[model samples]
Target: MSNSDDSRARDRLAVMAGIDVDNPELRRRLDAISARTAERLHQPVSLVSMVLDTAQFFPGSHGLDGWLAELHGTPGEWSFCATAVRTGRAYVVPDATIDPDQATNPLVTVDGVRSYAGVPVIVDGHVMGAHCVLGFDQHTFTPADLAELQDGAAEIGELLQSYRRGDTPA
Candidate 1:
């Protein structure tokens, strides 16, 4: 499905979850939560991203520089996070070197990102984007890790509701 279609599904899910996407405080909370999740997961990079009709926006990220660059890079096809949202499921690559999908993806190779784990950031029930973690070494993700990632995604949804309630854009 297209990005907008996916986002619309997420928005509907958010509404069902009683999350208000107009709150401004949600942005701060999302940022803080992203940091905490990253630290807890012991991952080098963690992000709470929103998939727009075109680009992905990282209102919250840890262990990364340049919001517009790292979090919000090219469109969905080039973004693993976007793929998660589009698929409405978790996507993990223990080693990009061995992932066929990464063959044409420059970021995975150029940045030496050997592993990546992403859970759909579901606002309500539809996935708006994802909460993702990246590692530089070959890493293995477990059921516990996936659980934690899903929890983080839920938190992100709540934060988005808060942001919407506050009429804030992120």
Candidate 2:
């Protein structure tokens, strides 16, 4: 995509408005979305992570040992999550080992991630973070895969909106 379009796409996420991550119901909804995403993608590791100044925090995830705690303090270099936020587009990494853009990411080298696909979770034009799925084996993705991931991320945003309006996520 063009840099201009990428910038506009990223500007579309307004996660800083209307909701706070500290809300319990919001966390619950994010977790549910993460779980469902993992299952739907048939991926062993899936995560809903939000980027902070120095780290990315996983409110929800599937697979990986001690995932919640372990993934909580991931630095920027370890963050494909942050990349999604920066680019404002879904990242479909068919092979992490060969992708120069992410070849040196700590998660790619140390975390055993071969294939990574994720969509940024944006709310009210602010980026919350990303909903990501990691495949242990190298793989290819289709348009359907991107659509599904995008839909799941949108659901996360919608859930946050619902919480703000005192309604349940649909």
Q: Which candidate comes out best when scored by TM-score?
A: 2
Q: 1-170 in candidate 2: lDDT tens per residue?
A: 79986665445433343456567767777767777888888888888877765677776666756554464547756787788888788888899999998787766777778899989887677777888888878989888877888998888777666665444544
In model 2, pairs of residues that clash are 12-125, 13-125, 13-126, 14-123, 14-124, 14-125, 14-126, 15-126
Compared with the true structure, model 1 gives a TM-score of 0.78
Q: What are the TM-scores, per candidate, against the unseen true structure? A: 0.78, 0.79
Candidate 2, superposed: residue stretches over 4 Å from native: 1-18, 71-73, 164-170
The sequence of per-residue lDDT tens digits that candidate 1 reaches over residues 55-96 is 666767777765344544456566778778778889998988
Give stretches of model 1 more than 4 Å off. 1-24, 66-72, 165-170
After the best TM-score superposition of candidate 2, give how far the Cα of residue 44 lies from its true spot, in angstroms.
0.8
